[model samples]
Target: MSRTLVIGDIHGGLKALHQILERAEVTTNDKLVFLGDYIDGWSDSPRVIDFLIELDKTHDCFFIRGNHEEMVLRWLTAGDDNAEWRIHGGQSTVDAYQDLDIHTKDRHVGFLARLNDYYIDEQNRLYVHAGFTNQKGVYYEFFRGMFCWDRTLWETAMSLNPALSKDDLFYPKRLTLYKEIFIGHTPVTRISETVPVNKANVWNVDTGAAFKGRLSIMDVDTKAFWQSDPLHELYANEKGRN
Candidate 1:
């Protein structure tokens, strides 16, 4: 079987991403899927996008839109008035694009604007930047609190109300059509291990790489995972500065 390699939040760490792909021995046959947050936090947003554009051209790569990408699209389209974009590591993103040409900037912005919110494989594996809420259909339209929000709602429902957990919140019977759900956005301390939220069906892979946490990758077929140590040195001084 071909491998579907899922990568976690990049947050502009192109070096770490390259290292992980090299370590994982990624091949052209494998379908590489990026969970989102490809740019922001780190110092190489422009380079990261450039690299992603190159990768997409050469490999079967799937891109999903994260909250960061949404903010970037908003900034590019509507201008940065809300100030919400800057709070979530937009300054670094801006810094990265400072030297880029106008045409290059426009191309990257257009790429972000065109990103899909989610991807569902034929095997029933749902890949989204953030996991879905109890809300049933039309999952992608409910973007306000979807892509970057925590899974606390589902966790609370699972713990406080077993009856509610037994409902569609924990394990959506309709989702039985898919094999698994893979997501990122909410940062975790470790990315190699899968956190089973709904009976081992849903997995969170953000791994908090942008915040000096691990950079993670998962194989879709064997479900094996690989991770690199926290790139703490890359962002040690930048922490809390933003």
Candidate 2:
């Protein structure tokens, strides 16, 4: 049966991306929901975007706008290159774009601009680069800094006492809106794990593809996963996400 594969942050690690797709045995029928950060880490940001653009033409792919994508969109459209963005792996993306043709650069900018902040699929499975703000239930409206930058949802989930049952009122209401909530942005490496980390109903799939860890892709419904080689090994000479 066809499956929905949710991918984690891909901070310009093109080689890792390719490897994970192959390792997962992704097919044209599979729906690839990417929790974005497609650019800005390794040296191949432009190449990575180009590959994704092509992938979209051939596969069912949904791209969620990430914090990095937001920064890049601002830089492309408004000439904003604040230190906050440039220092955090954004310079590599800028350098990568410098090599693209004018039309190709515009295409990339359009792709980034069209990315959604979050996607709730038919199964009510939420896919986002970062967790959404939980006022009470799910907030569909874009909450400026929350969608692509918030970690509170994940933090809360991580703090949940596994001893409590799902029926426990101690569980946050936000988690009840969906069957599963898949996110990226916060890498699992922070917890010393190089694989997807699950807490409560939240699954963080970013295994730090831009750093020392690997790129990850998981079957959302099945919880089966695939990972690429470590970023350092994938790009032995490049300084990755810092």
Candidate 3:
């Protein structure tokens, strides 16, 4: 049977991406939902975009725009090379694209433009790079950036009381908005988790590929996952947004 795979943040670790894809035994029939951060950090940022553009041709792939990608889009369009972005892995991404031909560069810009802020599946599963905070859910979310930068959704889920049931009146309405929410951006490694972490209805997939953690891809239905070698090991020669 075909499967829907939800991937975590990549942070330009193309080698890690390849490893997990192979280990997971991905097939043409599988649908890929990438949580984004496709660029920045590691040396393969540009090549990673190249691979993703090609991958979409053969497989069903949904790309979510990450905060890093937002920064990239800004830079690509208006040359907004702010230091905040540069210090946080944007410099590497910039350097990676320095030699690109105008045509390929424009194609990448188009690709970035096409990224979705959030995607909701038929099963009521919401896939976003980060999280949404509105109690009424995505449609009512006032700031679209929340989809790619918010942490309150995950924070609330993590801090939810174990005794609190969804049926309770005190239940967080945000959690009730969707059947399940898959997000990345904030690395699970910060909480010392080496694997995907589930809190309430929110599932965090970013295993910190931008830092020292592994890249992860999970089968949303089964919750079974595959991970690559620690990114630090894969790109031992460079400091990847560390």
Clash count, one per candidate: 2, 0, 0
- Can you tell me which runs of candidate 3 are displaced by over 4 Å? none
Q: Give the per-residue lDDT digits (tens) of candidate 2, residues 1-242.
A: 79999999889999999999999999998999999898889998888899999999999999999999889888888898887677789988888888678899799888988898788888778888888776554565456668899999899899888888778877677777788889999988999998999998899999988888999999988899999989888789888876
Candidate 1 to native Cα RMSD, angstroms: 3.8
Best-to-worst TM-score order: 3, 2, 1
lDDT of 2: 0.87
Q: How accurate locally is residue 13 in candidate 2, as Cα lDDT from 0 to 100?
A: 94
lDDT of 1 by residue, 6-123 (tens): 9988887777788789888888888998988888788877788889989988899999988888777777667764555666778888777778788998888888977876788888
Best by lDDT: 3
Error of 3 at 57 (Å): 0.4
Report the Cα lDDT for candidate 1. Answer: 0.71
How well is each residue in 127-160 modelled by candidate 3, as lDDT tens digits?
A: 9999988888898999999989999988999999
TM-score of each: 0.82, 0.95, 0.98
RMSD of each: 3.8, 1.4, 0.8
